[model samples]
Target chain A: MPKLSYLKALHRALRDEMDRDESVFVLGEDMNFALTNTTSGFLDRFGADRVLEMPLSEQGFTNFATGAALAGRRPVVEFQIPFLLLLVFEQITNQANKFLLMSGGQRSVPVTYLMPAGGHRPGWGAQHSDQPYSLFAHMGVKTVLPATPTDAYGLLTTAIRDDDPVVVIGPLACLGVREDVDHADLVPVPLGKGRIHRAGTDVTLVATGHLVHEAIAVADDLAGDISVEVFDPRTVYPFDWDLLAESVGRTGRLVVADDTNRFSGLGAEVLATAAEELPLRVPPKRVSRPDGAVVGAAPELDAVLQPTREQIADAVRSVLKESGWGA
Target chain B: MSVLDEVPATEADSAVPDSAALYRTIRFIRRFEERAVELVKAGEIRSGIHPCIGQEAVAAGAVATLDADDVVLSSHRGHGHLLAKGCDPARLMAELAGRATGIDRGRGGSFHPSDFSANVFNATGTVGHGAAIAAGIGWAAATAGSPRVVLSFFGDGAVSQGALLEGFNLAALWRLPVVYVCENNGYATTLPAGAAIAGTVVGRGEAFGIPSSSVDGQDAETVYAAVREAVVRARSGGGPSLLEMRTYRYHGHHTFELKTRLRYREQSEVDSWLGRDPLLIQAARVAEDERARVDAEVEARLDEVVRFAVASPYPDPATATDHLHADGLRPRPGSAR
Candidate 1:
């Protein structure tokens, strides 16, 4: 078994895909030096044509990738975040995403938007931090946020292969995650599937992105005292609702830990869906940022704004308390 | 080997359609637009379309330079573009009528439609965005060593859009084989081009280091000649070129204007443009009898087109969410799975 880091998994998946498919090419800003390290050695291996270094014009390049995809090529665009994905929000959401439906299925825009620096950056100002995966999902653009190294590699591979516009958000929080795995087992993970890290009889805890690892830790910390099931919906858009239904069915208690804002965020969607469909014994609790939150520059303020493990644990306990179940 | 030597400019003109063929296209576009407008009046096309009545030459001329393999990205006022690019008139009419037999499954009624079958890749509803989209297609073709030139058609209004200029930059930088034809219809919806765009239309391209020029958009041959040279340059690996065609739309910006009577453009200005009508200019080249024959043929075909469009079935409401994904992934409904 070999240890693979999350960043490496992303890099490996990109290199492998480009190697496998001649039509697949990388387009984005600052790829010559691989400033993001996602396409570290791509310029040499893939050549300038395949690993293109686009100008700083994000909107122009985003739509350009759409055109490339429309012309029968799969363009994996690297959007340097802080606001790269946000800048081309229309290009992806309005233009690229709608190409297939608007074309009446005559064409497909398989342009994968990879945001390596998505989610909150510690002590960074609002400018350098924002998670727009929910935005893409809301716009019906296929969005994925892999929580670990293996999931990162597998999900990214699948995203490239998908014949629709997909936004792969590699959140900074989960970038440091590493796991020991057999190389052969690193395979494509299907979109709209969930990986339940730990199963518990008491409550189903749904988490996404970096919050998944945080959720698993809290579930472990509360092991003997409380039973908690940590479920990671790898592909956020075509969510693994069936799996969530099964988990919540057994526990009858639910808690969601999402890194985005509480108002109209991923957490809100999960809570809403659970309320509508799930057979819940207790009122579900969700750990998420306040309405329209921006992680402040100060480290402490940033830490406080984030959904910590304590909040997840407290949310689980609160749901149990509401049901009159022993904590 | 130089790609220029391989595909010379002189050799490109050998494929340019004869004068009779050009007149037929202009006449066909004029008739198609008039018929489409009638369908709009009949309420077959729920949302009234942006009628490209007066500006037929721009589409006819620019598209004629393109080979069957070349692709085009069109704007909102793009029925003429689709027709000139060889889209089946029946299917296009069906598309406008919101029928299942339409080119886009009736999903793209008027604003956004892409007929890959006709090499018309897309018609973006968002103004000016088609420029960058076309640039992308050109980049892909050049990268693959394919000699396919991409033609992007936009209104003078698009010249002011930052995204459009950004598209110009990429096309110029990569020298990606693309022909950017700006149909300067002198108005962006209602606002005069003079008021909407600062500097000039061709200047926008020149600022981007693109080989930019202006042509008489009303004359099919002039439009053809200018775009033909640019197309040859593109096929020979010469970067993108921007040709601002001086043209106009006779009807209101859209059918909505028909009832509203926006009164934006002066009647005198309208009368002036109507004087140099593209149909008359192209018809002059062909004999009167031949022109009359084309006119009759066009009317007969349009009659069948309208009939076929009316006969075609509208898509089932249940499949409204279909084609959202190319793989046909049925999204779980908003309610629940």
Candidate 2:
């Protein structure tokens, strides 16, 4: 079996889709040079026509992708930074997303907005570090944040093939993560399906994107004293609530580790949903950044703002204590 | 190809700009808008429309230059644009009436209707965003080796929007087959164009290296001649051209103005624009008998349009979410739990 890195998985997905469908092409800044590495070797393999280099006009090119999609072409647009997503938010949400409904289903905008370096990078400051996947999910856009290399490969492929516009956020923290996999086993991961990384009876730790790795580590660290189930909801918008319910039902305990801000974040939603529907023996806990958090210049300050494995372990312990198991 | 080569000498091609046809189009738009206004007053149409009564010639002339296969991205005030592009007036009227038989199944209403079957891709409520979308469509068509040119229509207000200018840059850089038509109606709602836009409308296109020009938007013949040249340039891979049509709106921005009586422009200014009415200008070019026939024909057609709109049923509330997603995935029912 070959080792596949998360970034390489993204590259493989783009290469494979372009080979499979002639209509699939990429347009973004520095695509020719593959500045993001997800588009690495794409220019040579797919030619300049398909791997287009765009000027620094995010709004212009964003809507351009929508127009191309309307004309029966699948365009994968790569954004270098997370804030660019905010810049073109209206172009994607108001223009691209609204077209299908506004046209009365006469057309579909099959454009993929790929954020290769989404979420925090050490000293990248406030603008560069944002996990805004929850924003898209709230807006009803199909949003995916794959936690593993294989899941990255699968979700990116699925986003391209999907008829409606989708936003695929490739967490910067997960880009270096690698896994052993057979190339033949790489397949499309359906949106809205949750993957239980590890099954346990004590507590269910629901995670997203790079946070799944943190949850798995916490689960391993607490293995002697507690059993933990790691549930990864690969797609955030069409969430696998059924699977989540089943997991929480068995464990009767829930803790969510999300990278986004605490207020109205994915973690909050998971806790709310589980509390409302699932049978929880203990009160749910959430490990997430504080309200309106911005990772500052200092490494120490930035370290505390992001959800850490220690925080997840603490949240688990708190839930256990609340259920009188740790007494 | 030279400008002369752009206009085919074939009789069918020449007849497209025939005097009577232009008159009928302008007359139809004029009467249709008047009838729609009456419907608005009668409460048949819920929202008051942004009538393009004075600027009918711009749409009629520019759309006539396009082939049936060509696509158009229109603005909020797009009823005339759709009619000129060959949309069924009855269906459009029904759309205004929020009827199930409307072009958008009554989902889009007056502000955001789209008639894909007529190649009128969409009418965006966002002022200048359509320009970027149009450029994308043009790029797609060019990449596919199709000669189809895309026309993006906006008002003078859109000239100042940064996104629209960004679109101009891309269109010029890629030589995308697009014609950006800016109808300078001298007002952006209550604000005058001079107060809102700096430099000039065509200057924005010129700064982007697009071949920009000004045309008489009041005359259908002049507008046709100017837009025909731009369409030719685009089809022959000359990239995009920006044409600033100096026109005006005879009515208020929306029908609500009929009650509010906002005084932005003087009544004299309104009278002056009305003097250059597109319907009257095109009517003069046709014979008196022909004009009368077109008038009577348009009157009868509008009667049928209104009748159809009034008789059409409203869409069932259960189907309100029908076209929300292409995958037909309805939203999950609310959970009390």
- Best model number under DockQ: 1
- Native contacts retained per candidate? 0.92, 0.73
lDDT string for model 1 (B54-130, tens) is: 99888887877778789988999999889877788899999999999999999888888778977999998878998
| lDDT of each residue in B147-258, candidate 2, tens digit only | 9999999999998898999899999999999999999999999999999988999899999899999999999989988888899899999999999999999989999999
lDDT of 2 at B83: 90
The sequence of per-residue lDDT tens digits that candidate 1 reaches over residues A72-142 is: 89999998775778888989999898888888888889999999878888888687788888888888889
TM-score of each model, paired residue for residue? 0.97, 0.97
lDDT digits (tens) for residues A226-273 of candidate 2:
899999999997899999999988999999999899999999889888
Worst 10 residues of 1 chain B by lDDT: B1-10
**Which DockQ values do the candidates obtain, in the order shown?**
0.84, 0.77
Interface RMSD of each: 1.0, 1.0
Give model 2's docking category: medium
